[model samples]
Target: MILTFFDQFAIPHLLGFPLIIPAMLIPLTFFPTTNRLAQNRLSTLISYTSKTITKQLMLPLSQKAHKWTNPLFSLMLMLTMLNLFGLLPYTFTPTTQLSINMALALPMWLMTVLTGLRTQTTTSLGHMLPEGTPTPLIPMLIVIETISLFIRPLALGVRLTANLTAGHLLIQLISTATLTLFPMSYTLTALLGTVLILLTLLEIAVAMIQAYVFVLLLSLYLQENI
Candidate 1:
């Protein structure tokens, strides 16, 4: 009954209710709540892991950067949860969309750039041209650097989109092939099923890694500004 191959990527509606409501909310269900006196091992593990990652990210930043830890940690947790949840069968991944990725990237990138412009105005502008630049190349260098600066958010979004899209496409292709080949060749179908399972596991790792990479790059961007 699927109308198109890309239906899996489509924003789904069920019973005239936007499935996106649950698609988005499911990630929140896994988050560790604050009101509990004692948490399960899974929650404790998530807390410890998040704290460890936050510390590593903030290590190179200044003492004043502590203010950013909360937001960055929260964003990382949200992204990680969204990604891991997407691996579930019949689920949609919002981070797979360029618009969502860009939406997440743009504001943080802008805030960092703005912070640089505000607190470290001279230093921020100076990032455009390096020291000991030949006078002849100064104009060209500034133009190149400026372009690179604006491209940061675009890069962030494209990276996340391309990676997730490629993985999902491959998964679809392999799964379809396995199903199609099942009747004619049991051996081939079984082989492909194994491959599909392996790919799914790999995709899970990729989902986590991509989320971390997104936040890690953002933190690096903040490092330049902070």
Candidate 2:
């Protein structure tokens, strides 16, 4: 019975077709194409908002990293849309999956490492150990720093997955309680329902914040490499 709630997170398939691909693609439909001017109010707003976000994200980055603006902007938009859509009834969250989060994190992390290695080999290797280290502590510090460096992608994936999973589970549990109590007590049910509404609103903010954070961290990593 406990597994029922988690089953919602599993990728659905039918007759050998994976549904997750379609789900991921659904967000693309909402975006306006660059072929036309965004004359409509909604389209204009979307354009302005996207540009503002891109600018903010690129502010701390060096000139070399500015080339990543388009890719990073699209990633943030996709992540934001997927997270918001997941809040709707009967929808699934792709970011809630560790594999999906890791897929997103690993390549970006590797790119940063590779860029650093290619452009600034000495600086990149220098990060593994501090200068003027005591002789006895040099080996231990290198091991610790190396472990931390390798753990970056794992940390990224786990942070996103754990936050979304915890929020969704709370929502499900509270919603179940509200429904189960309705017949016995209208007053308590109404109160719980109110709390659920507030929690849902909070989750919406969380969804957006988490998406921003994911991209912001990537930008920081890029900054270090460049």
Clashes of each: 0, 0
Clashing pairs in 1: none
Off by over 4 Å in 2: 34-37
* lDDT, candidates in the order shown: 0.86, 0.89
Tens-digit lDDT string for candidate 1 (109-218): 99999999999999999999999999999999999999999999999999988888889888888999999999999999999999999999999888888888888888
What is the alpha-carbon RMSD of candidate 1 to the true structure? 2.1
Q: Which numbered prediction scores highest in lDDT against the true structure?
A: 2
TM-score of each: 0.92, 0.94
| Model 2, span 1-226: residue lDDT tens | 5898888789988799977887788878876676665467777787788888888999999899999888787788788888888898877789899999999999989998998999999999998989999999999999999999899989888988898898999999999999999999999999999999999999999999888888899889888888
Candidate 1: regions farther than 4 A off? 1-3, 15-17, 37-40
